[model samples]
Target: MPQDRIKTIGRSRIQYGPLSDRVYLMQLAAGEAEAVITAMAELAQAEGYTKLFAKIPGKNAAVFEDAGFEIEAQIPDFYADGDKALFVSRFICKNRRRSCDAERIQKVLEAALKRAGAGIRHPLPSDWDLTFMTADRAEQMAALYSRVFDSYPFPIFDADYIRHSMDENFRYFGILQNATLIALASAERIESGVEMTDFATAPKHRRASLAAHLLAAMEADARQNGVKTAFTIARAVSYGINIMFARAGYTFGGTLVNNTNISGRVQSMNIWYKPLAPCPSNG
Candidate 1:
């Protein structure tokens, strides 16, 4: 198995790994502009990666392009606010020529994503026994996710993502009632603050405020870890989640137009951010 690399450039956070011939980049923060450029240049030099790819907010498209990345795809109305997203990539070495027309490919992919209506929600319950997942816990979490998101691709609830969470110093919590897994949430540090990911609750547990309880617990954990802000990318269609985050004092940061690819379709995502008492300096 190959190990993924994570680096903090200034306040920005980046994660990258080799997926075959291409280097797949995930979780690039907006604040780490110079750091990402320097780090990418170094990675290109050392790893001989042919291409580097990332998903970024539409507003930040020009920054990546200026850094040598080209738009390979764009998804419209893919976020909760119906904003657009650009999928970008660049050849590490100038000598490596790309074969496909990036603009054209992006148009095709965006059309397909528009047809798929997968959406997300957030700021869920914080109650129950929430902790890192064990093998048994993974199975239970998968089953709950499958039931909650029957139309979307279920996450590969293996120990690897869980271990990755641990490596990043993230707290992965699962809610259990009567020893049965009912909900889950994850919090990881980012350049801006802390981001909550992979929040889900089983259908049977919905409307019972399980998600709200879980979110409260997650927030408490984040505060303990020196995280002063909380954020999430939620589905625009998920009214319940949006409301929950609002009730918790999280303000609307912005939306990533088409940031999520689900069930072979594109959907819009909303960016919700909350200041956890004292905000962390982006210094």
Candidate 2:
């Protein structure tokens, strides 16, 4: 098990969980943010981290901006109660930004959706099964993840991590083939929004549309739970998963440049999101 690297500076909770290279500002203290950010930077450098990122409230944005953090993406009224959130990042490694136009992401999502209208009406496999995972299934889930992924943002490969997360506002779903689990995904409640994350499938099960099926169930659960925004910070170079989000109706938000260290190296991630409730901008 990884050590608890969450630093409590004033009232803020800065975390360095399983994904070690990136320190997460899990809860930015509402007051004394400037001081907290300063402390965060110092600690991040001391830890030899490459990045410091946060999903922060819009009200405290200036503090992060003043600390040399850039806004990677934003969602209006993201917090189910009408608050906005910003995905901000500070690079302790090399100061870099990838070129990712909002319009370009829209174009890509549109093209992907055009190519696959079937995702809109996606249905589960006839013989396969979808069920919410329980704590007893943690070891089973971890073993399945090992077959598909080398690394993940969180510590899903560890049954203890899975069990702890499942207790902390995370809902997991799995697809069973002949009563054996072959695919898995999770929706983690963050503030008022939900991140459709931790998606994995065995190599033998690829191209079988299991992900889309599980995702459909995940989103429906989100809507029922009153989640307003759904998003994913997916691997940028992953054509199939990226397309899957677009096909499921998530629009492109922006790119997080070399932000995540996954599968043994630092990888750029694409932001894809969708609104479950109608937007005021649309009305």
Candidate 3:
């Protein structure tokens, strides 16, 4: 299957394609909100997409709202300039606005919150080691993501993309057993915060609490690097990931309706966030 395409429009970055049947305004550059808004609408119309999702600074949300966009989630003080981050959406196909799995999504959220902080700091298995990934491991990382998800919003199945991202504010973490990568995650730097995403574990490696372990390490790394916050847009129906984030002290923001395409289908996502204290610089 063909993956989504990412491109820049008037200094703004976007991802749009049939894989997700939506256009995502991934980054809205300064003074480019109007251009992005127009472009996203045209692209969605041209491609027959069902949704137009955007992550914009709170100050510019009124522009999008004036264009028929609605707020789905918000992150307070997400940017270095003290502006909140808003996840806004405009629905092209009205039917795509509702989720049939609302009950399950809620159940998962409740369960995760109910088990918050239970064994989240479990020790890594004796034979496994957690380490930061180098470029040489890009192929292995891509392969791991391919095995875990049939389709994803990002081109994680491509080694070159992984390498390029690693060079641009992306820190990947992996767990290895006997020197072979088995589980993986990444932290993407965005201004003063980092988005903890791209989590995947081999089928055989499930139920071992590896995601929580990776989150803890990612948080430590972020603090040491002066990052102030961490957040994730996790699949709402996924009990494991939601539980893991809640267990690690992340607050539940709000859910995005039919926002992402992952594992071969469109799914709503839940936002989770946590504040991190910046550690004294060792250097």
Candidate 4:
């Protein structure tokens, strides 16, 4: 049986899952460290969870390790601001054995990474107008996204998605030409840094550097907001977008293969990172 728990710790909500003889934890914060750890151990014991697995920030990793969790994987700069993310797992009782599919997962991830390498471009454009997308501009932005990614996995032109993006983050930008949306980028802020989500340019406006302009705008917004770096997971098939990012000075950081299933195939994704300023610190 699988059960979930939502515990309020300070201003953050920590969500955890207990399944079979295993527990999975997520949405942890620094302030609630002690409580969360205690709750996890208690839950593991009560629910007969012999093992626990979680992804946590590097800063709070010591707490988990001290609690007997072993660092199973280290994803560098997995979160914003270049904070490394640690995957930790612990065995509760001596007699219990936990089975894992780590190797299969890793192989899928590696395939995705290989795909990312074939289609990316770093160091994007420098000069472009970037602005927040309002209700008035939502339709135009959607149209442009549709034109660029006609077969995107998610409905890019949805009004609800646009509103959610605006409400959740200040990292959304639109490239306008004569007051018409030609390109767009959306991002969300995380504890370690900013994650670039959707970036697209109208097909009719490609080659004219509309996507480049949009990225430049995103960079400006990142700087203004004290963001240290910007990162993204790009589809391995999008050659044009990758090329523009490369031209603008972004670097290939890492990749997550088959992390996302898109267009009926398990698409590979490339991770890219751009430092906002020289010698920037994520913390």
Candidate that would win on lDDT: 3
lDDT of 2 by residue, 150-268 (tens): 66666678899899999888999999988788999999998778999889888888778788888888888888887888988887767678888877778777777777657665677
**In model 2, how large is the Cα lDDT of residue 135?**
94
lDDT of every predicted structure (CA atoms): 0.58, 0.78, 0.92, 0.61
* All candidates: TM-score: 0.56, 0.86, 0.96, 0.57
Better of 1 and 2 by TM-score: 2
Give model 4's TM-score versus the native structure. Answer: 0.57
lDDT for 45 (candidate 2): 75
Cα RMSD for candidates in order: 9.9, 4.5, 1.4, 8.2
lDDT of 4 by residue, 1-283 (tens): 2234445656445444432344556467667766777777787778676666565788888888888887655556656656776657676765443223335434544444455423223333445445777766777777776665534434566766677667765456886666767778887776646767677766676677666666666677777777776777676556655556565666665443333334343344555666677334579
Better of 1 and 3 by lDDT: 3
Superposition TM-score, candidate 1 onto the true structure: 0.56
lDDT of 1 by residue, 70-165 (tens): 875554433334455556767665544432234543443344334332322343444456565654455666566556653332233445555555
Best first by lDDT, ranked = 3, 2, 4, 1
TM-score of 2: 0.86
* Best-to-worst TM-score order: 3, 2, 4, 1
